[model samples]
Target: MASTIKPVLPTSYKAAVIEAPGAPLKVIDVTLKKPGPSQVLVKVLACGICHSDAGLQQGHFGPHLFPRVPGHEIVGDVVKIGGGVSRVANGDRVRGTWHGGHDHTCRQCHMGLFQICDNAVSNGISQDGGYAEFVLLRSEAVVRVPKDLDPAQVGPLLCAGVTVFNSIRKMKIEQGNLVAIQGIGGLGHLAIQYANKMGYKVAALSSGSEKRDLALKLGAHEFIDSSQVDPIKALKELGGAALIIATAPNPKSIAPLTGALGAAGKLCVLAPVGQLEINSFDLISKAASVHGWPSGHALDCEDAIDFARTHGVTCLVERFSLDNAQEAMDTMIQNKVRFRSVLVMGSE
Candidate 1:
């Protein structure tokens, strides 16, 4: 079957190539390789600029791998399939995981939690990712895109959407529960919408009065400016929040909110962290739990996509052409992007 399909290679396809940590990104022409066994080759339509890529840029996710392409929130169409790849075929719209492929025979995988698989292949860190004209994905890493959805918006949904949605689900947060989503940036903005759709009395927790109006308009029941009035106090006033999902990695910004949890409430940390210091008795007294969630497994990813498609959820993405890779990365670093930044390639 592999021999039947002729290999196609086009010269001078541009890709964002990161040669080293803390260095400027370069746009270079790279040769495309055919799919290997159990791999699918995708012509990227759009890829989101994720903070995980920021971590990759700063060497936080371990030693830097030079000549790495770093956009994991990918939405594209499969262009070719390798031997034994039955999950998807050419021209199928898809989005892929940040953790590319997990060893499915592991105990965690058996339990349907592949994100924590003993051996995981992470895009842009341990493996090549989506900042190129073509991306090679293991068969299990890809998820089908709903026909009605915009591929650009779906890119962020693959990562941030699943992260927040899964965390919200894992916390077992109930409808009508007071839920506060900290940070009103990329992840937090979407988290607010998802929380609202799930019937939570959501509050957008940000640092200033500036974002308050926009947050409320986005379905947050109320907006709390942590810079002026105390956010913990504001949230606590709402019968204490049943859950707080911290999407920002700033430890200091999140630590103070721990005490604001309602009776038996839980706080789920979805973003990466540095250090957070909290009093032990804060949890002991309330019987609350502090849990950390990695990126989602296959099921969670599916649920996120379905929820987004069903509820009209979408990222407010600013699109850039594929050749403007450095500009996109710089926009992400400057925090200038409103919600998400995505690079668009061939026909979407």
Candidate 2:
């Protein structure tokens, strides 16, 4: 028999760890295990700080194990691969999203709904994530990224990008449809770009006039300042939105926008705000619908990256070092980040 070669692994690495719920993340040394079958070790180059991470830290996503390294929008290079891993190899650049690993035999997985697999492992939530110098990832959760793209810019796409893409794709909105994106923050900015590129007559809906220029710059055909004018009326004047993507986390901000939808219009909530109160009359009269969309699996992330690359869509990011992860998380939580915050490690 030919000799079998085993991949060498690192003994320890640095990580930003949350010791408790509602506590600040601290950098700590952690030991690593060799990649098991179907797993790969990654040297994290950049990791995006998302609102979901804040929610998880604040116990909003339910109970989480302590000392967790919270990050899902991970971009890195594969350092080692375990047995049976075939998707990626050593030295390959890749990205990982919220959908970690899934049991292939599950009904959801069998039906190609891998994002909602009955037994799914969540990166950074259920297990250690990329808020570290290194992370061990399931090969099934990794997607190859183009080497030409900047790692820092690509990190947020793994989560925020794939999320909006999957949601918009599911809507099947036709070209030239009036689509409004509420909130010009991390998710909204990307949604606007995607909506515009996908051939929608895009409208940017935000709280103030300040984002009007930015929204237009991102390809919004029209900007609706919700603070000064009624967004519902403004959108109605534009023939009403055929599809409204609610990216703002505040339910109060979203409830009114529900009325902005035209007949058979759909409101897709990408942000996870609790307990929304929509007028029953709006749904009954206009036949409107409201629903939530979680992030997609790795293949969806690949498609998002490909589309973004082709359309020149990129994230406006504030870079933070691995040591300053606490500040990064704080900036994201306080809504101070312009669009997205990414932790840069190693050379990039």
Candidate 3:
């Protein structure tokens, strides 16, 4: 299939493009192209700003990765589909996630691990993403979403919301187990609600009392103020966490939580930060382990969306225009967004 094909029409839309490393996002008019075979073209309604976008700005995943439109948590309406596409039709509400496009013939794909395909294409990294008026998506990565839902609110679910919901369901712990979320930020806030709705004993762990009431209001059974006390000792007092989800992107804060894992428990680290310091004996004694999770595929994203919508798991989001894409990304990376930052298009 053809990739990055040019449009016949001249200057059809505007996008927030990263002109170069360390440069601010520039909104410029561009020719919007049609989808290739097995591809879909979407009119973007909203796209969430993720902290991971900083990697694209800082030239981390490089040699030649600039002029890219950085965004992955995309919520939009399908406007066109290329040949060989049968899964969805025009005007359908859909979401494009991080697992942009996958080569289905790879060994990992054969095992149903499309997210880690040998030639996995990541939206916003491997290709232009939803930081624009329109985005082209592989048919396999387009998840059909609810039309009635708010695009700004549901956009994050395609990433942050799904990351937690999908990973938590796949965790070794079962419902009603004590699940602790170690952060009160973007991913952590959603994690609390999902854990509670999924029938777990939810505990929200953070550095201060500011988020204590907010955590309980979001369904956490208890709030562990790590600023006033040791979160590890507190989780241990609650009989140890069956699962501790480290959403805070600091390895130092995450590593010590391993000591609070119960027998055969798991510490699921979601952040891709620095290396974690863990004692082998601590895990060996309890049969516990630390691991990371990549966000799920389109079908899994569908499940996450359905669960959140059905259970009232709403994402708190701050809105920005496509012109302010740089500010949105900056705010997200600086942890200034109350939860998630989304770029809203056409007053949506």
Candidate 4:
């Protein structure tokens, strides 16, 4: 059985939209639509500007993305709900990540791989997303989040946070094992924290020595400045990096890390910097494997959130207003955002 609820709401709201490929996002007034069956109407609070949003701006990911509202790292309050909505209700705080709605009929869904459904619909990609005052979400894609967490700070966890946490959680890492995190930015910073909290000896790999203190403060046990020394040689000296999570998108920077893996180690690439060129012998010789990860679904997002909350792991973010979305998106893609860029709509 399902119950439907609708509250007093506005007829229209402000939203940031991408009109076409390579175009800057512009704020515009959008008429609101009531939630349909198995759907939710959320009052958008905070949404992070992720680097992958570039895919939306460039019309890359979805079949029809023009006029898209691009934002996957969402934190909002449930305002209304259509039938079949038992997981959450009005006033509940929640976060929605990259895994949008899925068509259960897909083969991937039948295999319980709903996150990567064959059709591959996504928040801020195939659908209108959180870069607005209000948005409609399918109940299947909504995850209830805690009320106490700061919307601006925790929003990025929906995407960037979940990606690293979900990926590292799969490694089944053991204590004292050396785990190297490539890059000290958005995904890498959080990866270091998650890896450290998971009982591994965390090393932060970056181009400069300036990030050393910050990386250490974020729970990295050591800092390897690639500019000063060969990271591969350094990792080899440190008994080989048991797991190397490459968070940078530059293929050139990520490819060489295969040589730094220990016996049967894995290099998990979390960034989307296009084609990578690597020496197959490096992986073959060490029994290492390189692979990429997609952000998890709703239940998985909850797990990532709960772990961060319990472990005191925090997401560092720079805030921007909805009016400044273009600047925020530009700054994020340019890698100038402190770590994550979040658009705050109102008081958290």
The candidate scoring highest on lDDT is 3
Model 3 C-alpha lDDT versus the unseen true structure? 0.88
Superposed by TM-score, candidate 1 places the C-alpha of residue 128 at a distance from the truth, in angstroms, of: 1.1
Candidate 2 residue 148 C-alpha distance from true site, Å: 0.8
lDDT of 1 by residue, 1-348 (tens): 123443465754678877887766687878878789999988788888887787787777666587688888888878788999987877777887787898889998998888888998887778888888888898887888865688888889878888888888888877998999999888898899899999999988888798888888888998888889888888888888899999877888888777889889888877678677875787899888788888696567878999988887678889888778778878988999998888888533
Give a tens-digit lDDT track for model 4, residues 1-348. 122455579999999999888888899999999889988899999999887787778767654568789898888888888998878888888787788889999898897678999876688888888999998888888888888899988789878888899898777666789999999898998999989888899989999898899999999988999999999999999989889999987788899899999998889998878788988998889888887777788888889889999999999999999999998988888877789988999633
Error of 3 at 164 (Å): 0.6
lDDT of 3 by residue, 217-313 (tens): 9999999998899899999999999999999888889988889999888999998877788978879999998878888988889899889988999
Superposed Cα deviation of residue 29, candidate 1 (Å): 1.7
Which residue pairs clash within candidate 2?
A: none
lDDT of model 2 at position 59: 79
lDDT per model, in order?
Answer: 0.82, 0.88, 0.88, 0.86
Model 1, C-alpha of 277: deviation from truth (Å): 0.8
Q: State TM-scores per candidate.
A: 0.94, 0.95, 0.95, 0.95
The deviation in Å at residue 89 for candidate 4 is 1.3
TM-score of 1: 0.94
| RMSD of candidates 1 onward, in order | 2.6, 2.9, 3.7, 2.4
For model 2, the local distance difference test gives 0.88
Model 1 superposed RMSD (Cα): 2.6
lDDT of 1 at 144: 81
